[model samples]
Target: MARMRIQDIAAEAAVSPSTVSKFINGHYDAMSASTRSRIAEIIERTGYRPSSVARNLRLDRSRMIGVILADIRNPYSSAMLGELADRSAAAGYTLTCAISGNNPSKEAEAVMRLAEAGADGLIVNTCGGNDELLADTCDRAPVVLLDRDVPGASIDLVTSDNGCLVAALLQEVMRDGVDACWLLDEHNDASSVRRERTATFERGLRSACARGGCIALARNACAAAAQLTKMSCSSGGSPIGLIAINGLVFERLVEALAVAGIDVPGAARIATIDEYPWNRVLFGGVTTAAQDIAGLAAAALELLIERIERGRGPCGSRRRIEIPGNIIARRSTRTDSGPTTTTPQPLRAHR
Candidate 1:
């Protein structure tokens, strides 16, 4: 149905535009009960909606928040979205989500579309490569980044403490007495968090063993399995530890290990950066560092709403907040049949 304007609504209801305006703004003191009912029926029948642009122009606010995710298929993104929606609703704001599918151009388009649609603020999980566009967008509406950062852009960021989490995970894995560590990841040029974690893993692995490196992931699960088999055979009979970069990588790695018929924590040890529901049972509880999705969502929404209420500030001044994650140790990374152990880290903030 075509969206009817206030003038059209007024004409159909046989009321003046002023009366319709007052009704929309909830000032019903002057209108009779019959007139109010008639206007409501007209609005419902016509499917009329007040123009957000016009409302924002007049009231200087939209009471709406926009969320742009690089890919909602990621469990992290989906979970965080739910938290953001609930929190925004409680704060009297509506949320609209756009999926970028990890495309930089699509991400830039989403930014423009959300801003033009009159979002009071934006929470973006960027796919990178749009630093300039994001910086320009900050001038029009507040933009708070989630899970990623653009070094060229001075924007607020809320993400997990990847360095500390990776360090802790590595420390635990090294305690298992593995001969080498290998990080399996897809091409992560567009993801800042993945890149940072990869670097941290490499640094920690080399410092501990001097026998590990980052390995590229293959799209085909069977091919990945062959790669793992080759790595295992070349490890000189010493057990090597494998680290999956994220949830997607974790799934593929698990399938590959299964295909290769390699026993967990026996032929090889496995751990991942992101957690999943099956992490506990699938292959006997894969060890993982679970990102604090709830905390990240709350912090991002709080930062964005706080900025919106305080008005836009100087573009040069920015904030970066990192919520710590939990490293859960399980059978995947240990040879013992003991219970799970969780190590909670501390939160950190950077300007």
Candidate 2:
């Protein structure tokens, strides 16, 4: 609803334009007491307010936070959104959320637009581009990096513990007697999360005797997988197991395996980096390092709000927080037996 205006109040009160302006602008010293009282009564009855005056009165407050998600298609992103919404509402702030479709340029546009529209703070799933713009924007308002991060940018970050998680998962696969393992990572520059995952996997490998073979799923995941296997067998080689980088990659691996008539954990054992709600029901279940979506979401919201409300100064120096997740062992990574009864628990891979 439109707010009451000073003109509406003056017309109703039958007063000169200057008289009302003086009264509204708090210049009542020259006005008679009766006239001042009349204007006040009219304003009270009509609920009149000057938009510009009101805006100037509370220039420090907007009560709105903006969110720039890298990709809404991610199930983790969806879960984080719901959690962020709940926390924002509880903290008396509304949210303006936008998706970047994992495009850096679109991410920059969304961030700039939201800030221009007066968002008090921002939570960004950065597409790993526009570092300069992101840093500059952070100077205006608190920018919390969610899930993914930008290189050489000092900003508050909340992400899963991909390092420890990956290392542990790889150790477990080794103990399971898998001769060779290949990690199917979608090549991209927009995701630091993927980079971290890949680095941890490489460190764990340490130039093992057995390596992996598979390449180019851009044209078609299934076709690419078919070609990868055909080439491997032709060259007298095969991957004993495969580790999918994330859910999308995992889905592609599943599709490829199905099309090539390769039984998971049989023809080729399988494990993935992300665990979804549907993981348990798929392919006799899948082994995955589960991300703590709720924990990450809550941490991101809390950290950004703290910086916004508590003041962004020396104490608010950019902080990076990593929350660990469970390594859920499902049948997809089994080496000997078939799929068994599934339970939600963290696998004992540390020992």
Candidate 3:
């Protein structure tokens, strides 16, 4: 038996091949509901799969967008990607994703591959040290930075206000009467967001210490949790509080704390900058600053569409949009006055 083509479906539906193609590509404007239904039914009956290569050649567009993430294992990154995909689909575009695994070289290679694949635009949660390659790509195509920044690349960016997030988390720790505080550092190059968060954390710590407190830094989440455990075990006195910079760091902290058999809020306190569904259920909810994933997705998509429409290279006129994150007060690192119980809810509800 021979395979059916789009022309067969178009003929059955009594529509032009271009009209059927436009409908298949999700361009519903100017298409009547009846026409859409007829075309959809015919295509389904015919088992027609539009050839993406032919469609691209006909329309001069791949009708696809690319998204790159530093690590897809992180729940936050995955959530953002999901939201971005939905928004892009609604806008008549498909999304292709690549995971860099936090490696700069891999990130660069992924960017080049996506560009070569004829992605109309790119949304990147960049790995550090790919700024030059990113700049070169932006020079050729529309690029939007998501969740992280690339220095010296003048492109539209959508990210949470990490500075305010860390500052607010530290404020809660101070209010809880934590005598000493520690930061779990995940070492990456000084991206704009990371630099801002570090500076804000230091400033907040300085202000808190003037009122009588101390802050320390750990190499990473595992080390920070370990040090906190050792300090709490050896001293047998006041409790110490620790702050994880992101959801990935928080997971490592939980693993380290569980290995050491440390009871959160009893032996020590814990807080972090981001929260997902598991955080609410696993540890009686962790106090965290939550980013607006939906808003971030909308903003990124808007910028990308604008850039594509303008056909402009990455330049000084592009805006850096920093969306504010909200503080979720949970039991893990909160003071005695903090909420005693928090019901586990879908993270999507918070958005």
Deviation from native of the Cα of residue 25 in model 3, angstroms: 14
Steric clash pairs (candidate 2): none
Tell me the lDDT of candidate 1.
Answer: 0.85
Query: Candidate 3: global Cα-lDDT?
Result: 0.76
Clashing pairs in 1: none
Q: How many Å off is the CA of 172 in candidate 3?
A: 0.9
| lDDT digits (tens) for residues 250-304 of candidate 1 | 8789889888998888888888887778888866788888888889999999999
Which residue pairs overlap in candidate 3's backbone? Answer: none
Highest-TM-score candidate: 1
| Model 1 error, position 17 (Å) | 18
Question: Which lDDT values do the candidates have, in the order given?
Answer: 0.85, 0.74, 0.76
Considering lDDT, where higher is better, how would the candidates rank from best to worst? 1, 3, 2
Q: TM-score for all predictions? A: 0.82, 0.76, 0.76
Q: Relative to the unseen true structure, what is the C-alpha lDDT of residue 7 in candidate 1, on a scale of 0 to 100?
A: 87
Best by lDDT: 1
lDDT of 3 by residue, 136-228 (tens): 898888999997877666877898767667777776655554666667656554556667777777777687662222234354656665666
